[model samples]
Target: MTNRPLPRSFTHVDTWVFDLDNTLYPHHVNLWQQVDARIRDYVSAYLKVSPEEAFRIQKDYYRRYGTTMRGMMTEHGVKADDFLTYVHAIDHSPLEPNPAMGAAIAELPGRKLILTNGSRDHAREVLARLGIATQFEAVFDIIAAELEPKPALKTYRRFLDLHGVDPARAAMFEDLARNLTVPHDLGMTTVLVVPDGTKSVVREDWELEGRDAAHVDHVTDDLTGFLQRLLPKR
Candidate 1:
């Protein structure tokens, strides 16, 4: 992560939009393993290609297309519903209920929302696994947003407008550094969750040069700890 000065203080905002998936659950759990396997299988089955070729094709398609689902839609004419169902059919046993997280979220001083690049079913499964599904007012996932994923200003703008959120009064909490960039630019306070078990560093090239560093208002290894600091003690 970039070594930058922290914001002096963060006001308790009216709306708090959270990113699902790795943000709700730690990344070290390797939840993506199942998702990746599903993607590979989907490519092989639908494209009628070899496993090796499917793997390569999946990566290539993901690179060219924003998401593997998008690639499937364009190439194999697979319906989005079928794609989401097939990919998210993974065992969610690794994720356990986090009561500490529930308490922290419950103590927060505003409405909370979930914004994710996954399907709503996937987001619901994750939140349900974490035992914090009830804390959010609504979940806006890739399907709800018409397949336009995050890191795009248009998505963020549309999300804000859809929810009647004022960017200046809202804050975004995410685990990915890249995902926080556009939110920061749109005047939302951004917080990056650098979980302690993260294997790789989470800095982007732009952040290293201090170009996108200003957008990130805070970084912490613990989401609950950050919330504890920002909210009153229970």
Candidate 2:
């Protein structure tokens, strides 16, 4: 992957907020498979639906609610906390500590935070598996943030306010392009992590023309390399 210059807006930031899940780890590992299975089981058991029906309904609910837990809570009357606990109970052994990523994160110049649409327990598990759980100053997960997920401008704003962060000075690194839009609007420098040889599917709502395209400061195949370029030597 090619290295790019850091955006001018990046110089104004003292904190970096990172998205968890697909952002912290590589996507091809299929780490979400276990979680997906748990979600399906929960749906089948609680909703009393057939496994086939549960799978179909779970997919639809995720599409509608932005998360399976959220859909379960709203439509199936499942308790949010219970659903979160159940769905995230999968083993995280697939995630081996990524020394390269851990080193890069260790060398970052400013405070770091994990912003995720999952429960704090899930985030902790992932981070611990990656061997970088102690690096971040704080974690703002769905429950901590009152269940408002990412790509929501309000959630981003609340995160900044809660952390006393200035958007103009902060940078957000995320795997999803759509999640970058809200931070970009809030004056934060946005970096899109496009894993090696991966092509990002343009969402129906994504307007990728002209100035809108410029809102994304950089795109990199690997976040470790991206951080090496953007952050000064520690």
Candidate 3:
């Protein structure tokens, strides 16, 4: 199989959207694992279930519903704010500052935004750790999306509408390939950020689906390098 050329020019893109967690930072950091544990704890306490049962429920919800929060909200009437607050309260110390990524994002030609299934506070904390908090114009979080997670067409539509973004002139970067489908369908360029092979990273089997699918226009392991490569030579 031949390697396809990455879209060298994003000059046409006016809105640059990025997913918060694994998309912005390397997955090897294990920051998400902390959040995952907190989510399981939350589920266990809220449902009064065993730890093992909560673990199962957490994974099940993620598979059935785009996010565990959404599934819990639909089935158990869980409050999104409470769940979000608890799950995102994990220590962010594992994430190191990336000035290179900040510079790369700062050089991108348009309105930068974070479109995350996570809460705004979580996004802000992660961005601050990445040293790129000031790069984004706004964060469109789960609360703003009314608890609708990514991979949902309605959520993507809402984000586009709320930001007055023209799909044809926008670009989205995310770690999960399935989450890019709606953006691809909406006519935005979709990039999938995969784990760099240097470290042993653990992820659910379902999370690995559609990685090489048609919806992904580009794929990269080093997000900062990829972003820098997209810039016009100075």
Q: Which of the numbered candidates is closest to the native, going by highest TM-score?
A: 3
Model 2: lowest-lDDT 10 consecutive positions: 202-211
Error of 3 at 229 (Å): 0.6
Which one wins by TM-score: 2 or 3?
3
Residues 69-121, candidate 3, lDDT per residue (tens digit)? Answer: 99999999999888988999889988889999999999999899999999999
lDDT of 1 by residue, 1-234 (tens): 957666635574888899987677776676866888899998899888998999888877665665777777887788988888898999989998998988889888889999987888888888898999999999988877787677767888889989999888888988767788888777788888765654753432332233246777887778877787877655
CA shift of 4, model 3, Å: 11
lDDT of 1 at 181: 81
Clashes of each: 0, 2, 0
User: TM per model?
Assistant: 0.85, 0.84, 0.95
What candidate 2 gets wrong by more than 4 Å, as runs, is 1-9, 198-215
Ranking the candidates on TM-score from highest down gives 3, 1, 2
In model 3, what is the error at residue 6, expressed in angstroms? 9.6
* Model 2: lDDT to the true structure: 0.78
The runs of at least 3 residues in candidate 3 whose Cα sits more than 4 Å from the true structure, single-residue gaps closed, are 1-9
Which pairs in model 3 have colliding backbones?
none
Name the better of 1 and 3 by lDDT: 3
Structural RMSD, model 3: 2.1
